[model samples]
Target: MSRKLLIDIHTHLYLPRYAQLLRARSQIPRITTLNGEERLVILAGEAATGRPVGPSYWDRDAKLRFMDTHGIAISIVSPANPWLDFLPPAPALQTCEALNSDLEEYCATSPEVELGGRRRKRLYGMGYLPVVPGQEVGGVCAAVEALGKLPHIKGVILGTQGLGKGLDDPALLPMWESIAKAGLVVFLHPHYGMPPEVWGAQENGHVLPLALGFPFETTTAVARLILTGILDKLPALKLLLAHSGGALPVLSSRLASCIAHDPVAASRLAHDARYYLGRMWYDAVAYGPEELAFVVPTRGTDRLLCGTDHPFFPPLKGEEMWMSVTENLDAVENAPGWSEGEKEGVRGGNAVELFGL
Candidate 1:
């Protein structure tokens, strides 16, 4: 029997140079040493209990080993959240250009993989952009143009916010047009969850913010884009939503109903809010088969791709395979009503076609 192709499209890694930049900062999203171990403190209230940072984040060898252990053949890595969102326009553009170059080199230099009958680079990348507030459209568009020239960059990862005002901001139209013209996918990820108070004063670690807040953040961003006609204006834009499209698949019907009741919103969209769901892609990182199965009906099997949010949700203890990886793998393999070929596509074939990998 032939080996099943497994490509992870949602992995994350910070290049060493980028890590050093974080280390130099003293605020949230900085990397600091706590009791002799480097810890990455990104989200709000994480400074006291930041996650450990090590080779798994930046070491090429460590990434390869993790991939091998999890049966992932190829990984499309991007910088984790808070990407260029903090920097001023000038510094943001400079850092975006340099980091994108490093990202291209990082993937371009990785060892090749033998799959089917061909040898291809084992790694690929999702580039970053200077999407910070006050960043001129020219700079953002320029980054998009430069990314088009990078052979290994298949897409660009983005946070929910766009130029400070959220994705619906009109200022991002030029950047959107440039990305679509360049034929690159947008991997929409959530960084800033809801306000800190929404989680209350309880110390629940990252459970509420990550599990609940992240999904809703993505849900709100995409909903605004749809209602505001971003999709209608740029039908060619290829967007891949992370975390199984957050809460989109489940809430799309609700969104459509709400739009139906609101005359203003009803006239705003070109189609039913749910219809746009078909126009976008989603990753199978829901951590459960049912949630994975739920998204397929919204867009069918073709739009679903497998992903592992590697190096973030690593095992709680030593050397064990990550549940985050295994759960997603099982979800794709066992999603109800899917044929063997469909499962294979979600496993890797879909990504191969989507990003031209």
Candidate 2:
């Protein structure tokens, strides 16, 4: 049997300029040396959470090699979390332009990798814009306009916090309008999880933050967007939710029940909470067949896209093949109640159609 065409829609890369900028800073999102190795510190309470930084996070050759080894035909790469979120508007705008340009160059020039005996691997760029706190709406729109003109840029990846107001603020109307007008898809990812206070004083590593907080952050942000009628207002906007809509699909019924019990919350949207679940696209990063099974019913298979967070979720067993990547593939391939054609769609067909890859 021939191998299926695979496209990874959720991978990330930090261009050299962005990495250098982080290396020179002293703040939380900065890079610091620990035991002669560069490590990325991205949160305020990151004293014990920083991961070792390496070439895979920013090198083009390293990314292509990984794609070849994994049989990924095309990878849509984007700037990872907390992306220019900490910078002031002027430098943030300039940094965004440089970062997008660098990403565009890599996607346009990356060598074709041999996959399944066919040299078919390629990379596509997802540009960044100056969406940060305290920036003037007009300045952010200017950045959006610049990104739209970049030929190789297919879309953008954004942190849950939209201009630090958490995506529900009316101040974001202009930026959303600009991206919608540009025909760019929004890859909504989570960077800032729930408050540290919610985690308590457990020294349990990243399980709490990664397993619980991250999904809740995305769930809350999207809920805010839905309740504020922003999703309804922007009908043409396309959003791809990271981490399988981040607990939103599973917890949707509970949210809808709560809204029903309260007139104020129920009055916020013209439609029910369940409507938004069907409105957005979801990535198959949930890690198990049963999880994908549940997600299929919530959003349908046509909306599913495959992703391997790469470089972020490395194999801990020192194996060349990442369990993070293979496990998700296994889940999608074996997910119950999905037809063969639907399985192929979840793997890469949806991404190809959604991003024009």
Candidate 3:
């Protein structure tokens, strides 16, 4: 029998060089020196206790070890969130180039270093984009074109904010067109959670925002893209939404109803509300079997891919496996009406086929 090939489509890595740069900065979202100890802190809620930060974030060997233990055959790595978005124009552009080059090289070459008495299988990566400093549409198009040529890069990982405004902004069309023309899939991930005011007085560490805010932000961004006719304009553009499209599958019907009721939205949009929803792909990271069942039918099983948001949700106290990852795997295992072949696709085959791995 063939082994169950597992591909973690949504894993993250903070390259050691990049982490060093972040550690030197003394900012809210950056690393800081407190009581003579340097630590990294991002979310405000997690600032008090401070989450653990270390080599597991950067060292490639650690990633290999984790994958070996977990049975993950391949990982499509991207730089963790808040990438280069905070840097100035020149620096951001340079950083983006360097990271992309580093990722491409890393993916294309096999490391001489071996772990667990065996050299690891080839790893792959998606390049990062400098969408913040709001580059001119020409510059943005050029950058996308450059990334598309890199041998190991399958796509670019983008945040919700597109060129400063949300993804729906009209100014981003040229960049979208260039990306579509390049035939690159856009791996849409989330960074900005919700407006802080929405979280209320909760100081529950990063739990509330990381779990709920990330997905919500992704859902809103994609919906806006649909509403603004971006999807209609670029039918060839393929998008992979993180966290099972961040509640989009569950709320699609309501979105359609709202669009039907609101003449403005209906008139502006070129197609039915759910038209673009079916065009995109989703990661199987909804945290439960029921959530997977809910999303698969909505997005279609072929478009669903499995992911482990590793390093972010490591084993909590007394937990042998990550609740985040196990829940996702179990979801695919138990999702109702999935034939064994469909389950195999979601497990990893879909990504292999979609990304041309």
Q: What TM-score number comes out for model 2?
A: 0.94
Residue lDDT tens for model 1, 22-56: 99999988999998989999987797879899999
Largest TM-score belongs to which candidate? 1
lDDT tens digits by residue: candidate 2, 261-357: 8899887777778877788899999999988876777579999999999878887768889887999999998898788998888888788789865
By TM-score, the better pick of 2 and 3 is 2
**Worst lDDT window (10 residues) for model 3?**
112-121
Per-candidate TM equals 0.97, 0.94, 0.92
lDDT of 3 by residue, 118-164 (tens): 55445778888777755766767877999999977888889887778
Range of the 10 consecutive residues with the lowest summed lDDT in candidate 1: 1-10
Task: Name the runs in model 2 displaced over 4 angstroms.
Answer: 1-3, 112-121
Q: Rank the models by lDDT, top first.
A: 1, 2, 3
| Pairs with steric clashes in candidate 2 | none
RMSD of 2: 2.4
Arrange candidates, best TM-score first: 1, 2, 3
Which residue segments of model 1 deviate by more than 4 Å? 1-3
Give each model's whole-structure lDDT: 0.90, 0.84, 0.81
Candidate 3 to native Cα RMSD, angstroms:
3.3
- Steric clash pairs (candidate 3): none
Query: How many residue pairs clash in model 1?
Result: 0
